[model samples]
Structure formats: structure tokens, C-alpha cells
Target: MSDPFIPFESISYTKRFLADCYERQSFANAKTVSYHTSYSFIYHLQQGRLYLQQAAQAPIEIKPMLLFYGIVQMLKACVLTVDPFYPENSTVLAHGVTARKRKKQGYRFLDDEIKVQKNGLFLHFLDKMFHVKQMPDEKYKMNFLLKQVADMHPLYSTMHNQDISIAVTQKSQSYMISDTILDDLHMTANRFSLFLEQSPNSKSWFHRQKGITALKQQITVPLHAAPTRYQSAPWLSTCDGDIYMLRKREDYCSLPELSIHYLLLYNLSMICRYEAEWWGELHHTFEGNDLPFIKQFLTSTTKKLPLLFEHYLFSINER
Candidate 1:
């Protein structure tokens, strides 16, 4: 008996293996367990955006379904990128087992596992963002998050209902998402990125940690208030000059803390850039009140991301 699991360290290898299996119809009898890296999710996210762009031109009957799938892919991408160590466990059954034995043992579908993992990730994000605690009822938590997300972006409500129907019936239905929904998705992604930036080590839940305590001590400047009017330099004559600088400085006092901010910024910028490339420019996509710090940082060109961050961002899709 040979080892049942096949390990792939690179996306190219994974792609080739899948393509070969697909061509041979090997998946008809075999199950695939994808051990995806952070970069793999990012790649899928980029592809999802591409599908969304295509959905705009698709016929009305199928447009909603396309958009729904696209948004789901982006959501999965967010979960994976935010916490690459998710699921936290792996299992492999012995190969060459009889189909009858597998049936008797009650095998689990990889798709079901993915849905469970993604739902957990979504719940975690909502709990932290809304400051909810000790919600033991899984169905209630899921419904609560769905309603909140729908309220935040009305388009999500329709999509959510349609998705639920599709899941229950295992059939596709016609649905449509507005261009405005893309902006909502962008804002949601930014908010999650900000949460990740603020607490890098706070992975399990929203509880305070000793690492955050140490980091907070290093942040001497206040993060709540806007910069004073006279903080501009004499050499600079631009409007609202140095406001971005002040905000960035106030957010992170040390290089390590700044690195976290850079990581989030890089991820957000990648999403923004992808949107821009696919659908012209992004105008008023983000709200100032919702993410003032992110708006400021993105508008300013005075500061550059750390060299290491730039390297990792560009190399994420490399073979």
C-alpha cells in the first residue's frame, strides 16, 4: 500500500497534477484534498475578480450565479490570506481501500470541509469586527452574521438568499449583483485587512494578548485624533500634506509593527490594482468615514512599503 496523499509545494505542480487527473477523469472515483498556501488563495482571488468582470457582460439569466460564485471565491481568498494556518489539522486515509469499505466508513467530501472551514473563518471575522462574545449557537451566529453583512451591503442580502437556496437544492439560479457590490466587497476586504493588521497574533479570538500589550507600549502617539494643522513642512506646499505621514507614524511606532501594516496595505492595494486593471479606475470605492487611515495611506505617495513586503507581494504568484 502506497501513501495516499500527494504533496505539492508549488502552485504550478498543483495545477499540472490537477490537469492530468482531470483529463483522465481520475476525480470520478478519487477525492482531492487541497493543502493551499496563502499565495494559492491570492491567485484564486485574482481569478475571482476576473470572473466578476466577465459577469457584467454575461446574460441576465446567468449573471447573478456568476457573481455569487465570484464573491464566494473572494471570501475564501480572504479567509486563507488572513489566516493561512486555518483548519489546523490534516487526515489521510489509506489508499487501495474498497469502495464498499469507504461507503461503510462514511467518507467526507472535500467541498464540505472547505465550506465548514470558510464558515468558521467568516464567523471569526464577524465576531471580532462586531465585538461579539461567547455565541455558542452556530446557526444563530451564521444567521446573525449574514444579516449584518446584508445590512452593511444590501446586495449581499439577495445574493445570500440565492446562495442558500442553491446550496439546499444543489441547483443554480439566476441572480444579479450591481457594480456597487464590488465596492462593498472592497470595503469588507479592507476592514478585515485592518483587523488583521491591528492584531497579527490575535488569531484564535478577539482577546487581548501580551504581544499586543508590548506593541501598544511602543505606539506613543494617539491613533484616534487627526493631526494638528501646523504639522506640515515648509518645503512641502501640497494640500493636506503630511497628514498621511502623521497617521502612518501614529499607527505603528516600530519596524515590526509597521511590517504588519505594510502587509495589510499590500494586500488591499493588490485588490485595488486588480480592480483598476480589469474595470478601469476605482472612484469613491472606499468611504472616508469607514477606513480613514487606509484612505490616507493609499492616497499618499510620500512613503514606500518596506522592501521585503514588496518582494513577497510580487513573488506570491511565482512558480
Candidate 2:
């Protein structure tokens, strides 16, 4: 297998990344901190790479445990680059989110929800890395989060018979979106256009083509939120190839991709660790939609997270 982190594993690469962060932050102790912190940052990322590599080959039963640790390691590395004084308190050391202690009967992973806590890694990571602070007590269902992942749309199409993602074509600086987004949105073209105008994410909404809608993203949009901040949808522009728009655009759908993955993986890791009875049944029995979604999700995250890490850390988009 080729190196998942070829030049990225090099110490110099992390040093440069840290140097950039130091410059961006203008830290008072940049000289001392950058030197010492680079070592920890590089190792955390390397360990993350290792854990995710193991997850890819590991059996389905053990994959989530590996993925959770892998994700945490990467998150720690990311935190260091952004905020050198991470773990300023013990609260940031915690996972920062909680799963239900006792799952109700007939529980499906899709319907299961996780509560964002007041403090911990989840809170710290999002606030530090993405500049977004969410309501701690809010609850999010697994299916809602999963729908935010564009690649997972196919499984949803198969199982739920829904199009969670729409492919977009680029036209110069803007992108051409599909009007199919309006189907489930219950909005006419004019209302949908009006909706985009009010959305924080929308820089400009061009006219709808034969069936295409076009918009340039407001790249500098600050990610602060009100209760209705998520009334808008998410638009991710890949460095290369196709772009996708998630339909419906509900709450959390507009969240940064990193946060989306972290939340999904957190719930998954919890189910893997705590809900063994249900997890075992899903794996061994392979009867319901749960196993398929679980298997597909694990597969999706394993492939996508590393590439996303590269983008977050180094501005490199591998795919």
C-alpha cells in the first residue's frame, strides 16, 4: 500500500503547518511552542493514520473502536495546529457529547440520537477548528447527520428511496445546481430562489437553467448561528471533479463536514462500545437496514476522513 501520508508524515511538514498557524495566530510564545508542539502534532497525526489504516482492514465488528480512536487522534492533532494551548482545562479533555444510556427497544441507528454536552472534545474541536459553537443541549438523530454526507446518498436512495444529494456542475466561478432539490423542499422555484438570497452560505443566486440552479458560495461567511441559522443548506466545493448539494437543508445539514463526520463517528463508536447486544444482532443477523447503514457508514468514513484531514490540515484535497 502506498503511504497514506507520504510527505505529510515528515516532521518538516508539520513544522511548516505549525509555523503557518503561529503566523496566523501571532502567538506570543510562537518560537518556543512551535518547536515543542510540532513533535506532538506529527505523532498524533501519524498514530491517526495508523489507526485508520488498521480500521480499513479490521473486521466490521472492531472497526468502530479503531475509527473512534483514529478520529480522536486526528482531532487532537488538528487542535494543536489551531490552538496551541489545547486542553487548557479538563473539560476540553472529555468527549463533549453523550449517548443515551439505555436505548429503547426496536432502536435503529438512524433514529438514535446523541446529545451535545456543554464541554469536552466535541465542543472544543468544533469551536477551535471550525469557529462554530453549537447549543450544547441540542439533540441530533443519526439519520439526519448521515444525510449530510454526500457519498452516503446512494444507500439512502436504495433503502429510503430518497435523493439526499444532488450533483452540481461548475460554470466559471459559480456552480450549476439541480432543481430537483425543490422536490422534497416543498418550494417553488421563486421561493427557493428567495430562500437562497437569505441564506448565509449563498453569495449569489443565479438564474435556474433548463433544470440547473447556480450559486457562488459566500466563502467568508462567519459560521455563527441562531435557532434558525440552519434554515440554509450546505454546499461543499471539491477541489476537483464533482460537487454535491444535500437536499432538504435541515438543521446540522449546514455544519462543517468535519463536525458532521465527528458526530456520526461518535454515535457509531458509542454503539460499538456500549450497545453490544444491538450491535451484535445487527452484525450477526444482518436483518434490518441498520447493518447495511452501519457497514456503509464505516466504509464511507474510513475512506473519506483521511482525505478530509489532509484538507483541513494542509489544504490538500486528495479526491
TM-score for each model: 0.25, 0.82
Relative to the true structure, how large is the alpha-carbon lDDT of every model? 0.29, 0.70
Name the TM-score of candidate 2: 0.82
Q: What's the CA error at residue 163 for candidate 2, in Å?
A: 2.2
Largest TM-score belongs to which candidate? 2
* Location of the lowest summed lDDT over 10 successive residues in candidate 2: 221-230
Q: Distance (Å) between predicted and true CA of 17, model 2?
A: 2.4
lDDT of 1 by residue, 1-319 (tens): 1211113335665545443433343333222323335346546556656655565566433443444445444444433433343435432111101111111122221111111122243344233222333232322211222111111222322334332110100112211122232242343433523443353222322222322121321211112222112111101112222121111112222112112222233233333334333212223443222233223333331122212122222232331
1-319 per-residue lDDT for model 2 (tens digits)? 2554676567776677677787777787776787888888878888988899999999988898899889999999989987888778898988888888888888888888989999899888877776666888988898888776666777888987766677765555454555556675777766766665554334323332322233453111112221111112455433233456666656325467777778888888888788889888886776768878778888888987877777666542110
lDDT for 287 in candidate 1 is 22
